[model samples]
Target: MNLRLRSNAIMAVAEQLVVGITFFVLYGVLIRSVGAEQVGILSLVLVLTSVGQLANIGFGSALLRAIPMHEGRGERHLSIASIETSALCSALFYGGLLLIAYYPFQYLITIQAGPQYAPTIAAMMVPATINVFAMGLGAVSTAGLSSIMRNDLRAVANIVGGILCLAIVFLATPRYGVVAGFWALAAQSIFVLLATWLFLYRQLPGLHLIPRRLNRTVMRDLVKVGYKLQLQSLLVMALEPLSRLLIGHFGTLSQVTYFSMAARYVMQMRGIVYSASQPILSAFSYLRESDPARQQQLYATFSTVIGLAAIAMLSATAAAAPFVGELWIGKREPLFEGFAILQSLGWLAVTVILGSYFNAYSLGFLRYNLGSHVVMAVANLVLGVALGWAFGPWGVVVALTISLVLAGLIMGIGNARFQPHGSRFLSLSNMATLALGCAAVGTAVAGYHFVRGYWPMLASGLASGVIWAAVMLPAFAFHSERGLILNLLRLRIKRRG
Candidate 1:
């Protein structure tokens, strides 16, 4: 990567790390102070907001694609106007939906949390709704910044906003409860918008946000491309929230807390992989156009590294859940149940990481396989609901895992056919690496069980780490691209030097 891209990637990782840690700490505090039920309320509201944000009708991504193209053609003013108009429309549409859904949402919350918590739930919704609108407006500015290759600014803005949110939540949740937490989130979203606008202004002093005539042609183009994307989003975005909703309705609020916390922890771990991989998507796209052979090779390497990394990270996390829970939640036993759920769904997480690369490959080749996405979406919803109802929280995760694996296989096969010959999904070496990684994880788990004290547990964890390294380093050195790992390590050392 060039210096600019490298810098942006580093900043992006930092931003995600900061935000992840903030939320992690914030959730831990909330769980300790207000109890699991209040945390469930907050988690439910946040999920609802995320699902509702899709009402933007996919214009957020549309603008990201459109802005760059227009800027390349020197139609910057028109692009700005077009994005602004789309954002305005999205905000209005989302706000209208929020208004319409308010009473019904309140009714559901009342049923779930009882009439005593109803007022708190209602108060939380006010800022939550405003946060959704703030996000809509901020999307336009962030898209513009990304198009101009100032994507690092977006990361910086997020870091600032996240810290502010953390502070607000920390200060307010003690006295005011969940309502104050939602208000903190609202402030964070608003800050993100302001920070993004400031960065955009700095980058393009001549750019204006004033309302302009709606460019019908641009609107039509965005809608044409966006509506198809929105269909997939509508289906996919509903899965997680709906799963939690089911848990909330069928199980107790405490179950919702367990389910959400486990899912959130796993998702945050996945985010680390995502942060590393996302920057490469554009690189992959560029290589597809300029160097198809190189693109195929890099895709193979990236998929292997990402898949193995996810397995290692998640397995390690699962093994250390006891320690983490001890520190974060004041009890290790309470976390075991959630950790079990994560363990049951471990392979699914790896596949989800790999599937992201596959999806990027499809996009890089300009092949949007709508059918594949549609199938994945449908399977997720149907299986998630059915299995969740039948088996409970773990069942929902099982359903998601099965759906993702099936969808990933379909997409992988499709992508392989498009690549040159000899491009395999799981090369022999890759499979061996995965096997050894799993073995290492099993060793760690066994050690945790057989060992007696904290000192022994620490030693076992260390031994497991050493064993994984011993196996993986040699495997990568001899089986795959020779010296690739060593070269990366040396380069990192040199950079530090």
Candidate 2:
């Protein structure tokens, strides 16, 4: 990647990390003040709102893919018109869904979560739903900006909006409770929308914020590309809510709190991977036409980095779960339960990171096959629900883990056979390194469990880190893109100096 893109990726990851930590702190406060049940209700509310993204109808990804191609082909007017039209359509679609489902959503919440949550849920629903609409609009602007290589502006907007959202949630949630958080989210969404629009307008002088017509031609093209994308979106959107709902039904709201907390931590780690890889996906798309060899090199570098980083983070999380959990939640058992869940689901993180790398490669090359994505989505939902029913929250995670592994294997095989011939596949050496990494993680977890105390956990973590660096770093540096990795480090060091 070029310096500008690399910097943008770093900024995006840093913003997400900061925002994630801020939310984590806020969640800790909410749990401490209002208790886990209230937090559980809040989690459910957030999940429902996330599911609202399904109303986007895959326009977000469609915009991302389409805007770049249109600009590349010098069809600037078409790109701008499509963005405006998609934004308008998304807002209308989501708004209408909210209106129709308002009463049904309320009834569902009351029946599942109980009467105590009804007022808060009712109060938050409108703003949260509005937030979804704002997010849809923001997606278009963000995609346009990114496609034009202005990702830095998008990162800045997100950071600023995140800070504002954190402040709102911090001040309002304590006094006004869960409803305040939803309003804060809505505010954050509007901030991002305005920021992205401002940056986008500056970047593209000819861009139109309002379309003169509906542009049926653009809409038809987007829909043709988006139908399969929307199915994937629906599957992704439904996973979390379904898992949480099952926990509520099969276990309890309290279990939802535990599971959501663990899942949040895992998701944040996954977010790091996503933020870092996203820019590369855009680069890959450009390289596909200009430099196929460079595209392959970038893919290998990105996949290696993603895999190694995920292993390190998840291992450390597992090793230090006791100390971190006690510190964050002020209770040992529930947090430990969350850790156990993480332990069982740790490999799932690696699989997801790898899967994302493959998907991005495929999308960039315009060779993405929807069949595997569809299968994985369906399998995940079925397995998640069935496993949750059979063995509770842990089972849901296990099901997800299995589904992800299966998907990864299937995709990996397909990539090896059908993707460009020279594209790197996981070799025996890489597999061996991964196995050793897993063993190191297991050692860390075991050491922490047997030794106990903060110091022991710290020691275990340090030892695991050392082992990973010693074994995996050398393996990657020697076996993969050594020059690229060395150059990246040198650049960072030079910048620091």
Best by TM-score: 2
Tens digit of per-residue lDDT, candidate 2, span 154-272: 87888788788878878887789867777887888899998998888777767665634467888888777676677666765666677778778877888888777777776676677
**Sequence-dependent TM-score of model 2:** 0.87
The residue-by-residue lDDT of candidate 1 on 76-179, one tens digit each, is: 67666666667667767787888888778778766767787877788888898888888877876776666555668889898988889889988898898767
Q: For residue 175, what is the lDDT in candidate 2?
A: 86
What's each prediction's clash count? 0, 0
- Residue 150 local lDDT, model 2: 70
After superposition, the stretches of candidate 1 with alpha carbons farther than 4 Å from their true spots are 1-3, 69-82, 211-213, 284-305, 334-369, 420-425, 452-479, 482-497
TM-score of each: 0.84, 0.87
Candidate 1, residue 361: Cα displacement in angstroms equals: 6.9
The global Cα lDDT (0 to 1) of model 1 is: 0.64
For each candidate, the alpha-carbon lDDT, in order, equals: 0.64, 0.66
Checking candidate 2 for backbone clashes, the offending pairs are none
